[model samples]
Target: MRETRRQTFDEVDLLLDNARLRDELEPYRDESIDPSINRMPLHAENEYLASMLAWERAPALPIAEWFNPPLDLMPPDSLSDAQLSSLLNKTIERLFSKNIVLRCTDHLSDRELYMIVYRDILPCCEKMVDVPGKAIEWMCVEDTETWLRYYASAVERRRYQEERGMPLPAAETPPYRRQLPGQ
Candidate 1:
């Protein structure tokens, strides 16, 4: 008869505990993927701080194995992918909720907000579409009939910046300002 090591429920529980321990150790394994909880305002008795300190002081940690694992150590390619997916999902959820709230408020028609968000605002946000995390961009429509009225606000802003000697975004030189070499 061959003797095999039979496992009990307690051993199974112990294995679960070990797996939990590994899960707990996951964040420390990757510095870049680690959440930056430091941005939050700190209190003397903050729970976050206490937990962070406690995590810092664990003994017999497989630090070397955790930090120096092979490329296939993680379940997926990178935690960045997880973070990006999380952000995009959250943004979509938030946007849906916000649309619901806006609809209920009756302050602005659904069509109005839809036009701004889709046509104008989304174009500006194209610059940030590649960026990680959630950001809401809005566009405002100006009702100006004449050229003077249309450009008055922009002119004021430019003049104000000029007067204050503030560095404004580079403006393209007018055709008149471009002197020919023979001139």
Candidate 2:
């Protein structure tokens, strides 16, 4: 009789199991998931869970280091409207090229967005890990008081009242809209 060269049924099952485990972990093995974690015993039963645990334990890095070239932004007030607009366009393009998208761009006027990009985002050294399948988002990070006072729509203000159980204050017109760039 010819000697059999086939894997045992149990061996095939183990191989399939390992493959499934790897597939489960595949989405988490990106740049944001620190590679320093031990990934030995490729056939471990809990490999997927281990990878997630390792990611949770990884040290965070500053957002500035996440970019190939660090952002060096100028003060919004220092630039003329024309210069600011030009720089804002270039900066937005640069950020988009790096998979860093600005959220709520449509909600903000040119000057508001420009101030946010210059003062809050560029100067921010916060750690913002980018997980796979999720875009890095930059948005207005102003205080709730300032946002509610200036930018919150009537609907948003009412929603905030219901959520916080606070008495709804009379909506005051934002004084900055008159000075909005390109207005």
- What lDDT score is found at residue 60 in candidate 1? 33
**Model 1 lDDT per residue over 17-48, tens place:** 54565466566656642355445433322334
What tens digits encode model 2's per-residue C-alpha lDDT throughout 28-142?
Answer: 5667544543354434444544446445544555444556777776777888889888888887777665456775355466677888777676666544433444355765535
State the TM-score for model 1: 0.19
lDDT of each: 0.36, 0.61
lDDT of 1: 0.36
In angstroms, the error of model 2 at 22 is 9.3
**Candidate topping lDDT:** 2
TM-scores for all predictions: 0.19, 0.48
Indicate the worst ten consecutive residues by lDDT in candidate 2.
Answer: 174-183
Local error of candidate 2 at 152, Å?
A: 6.6
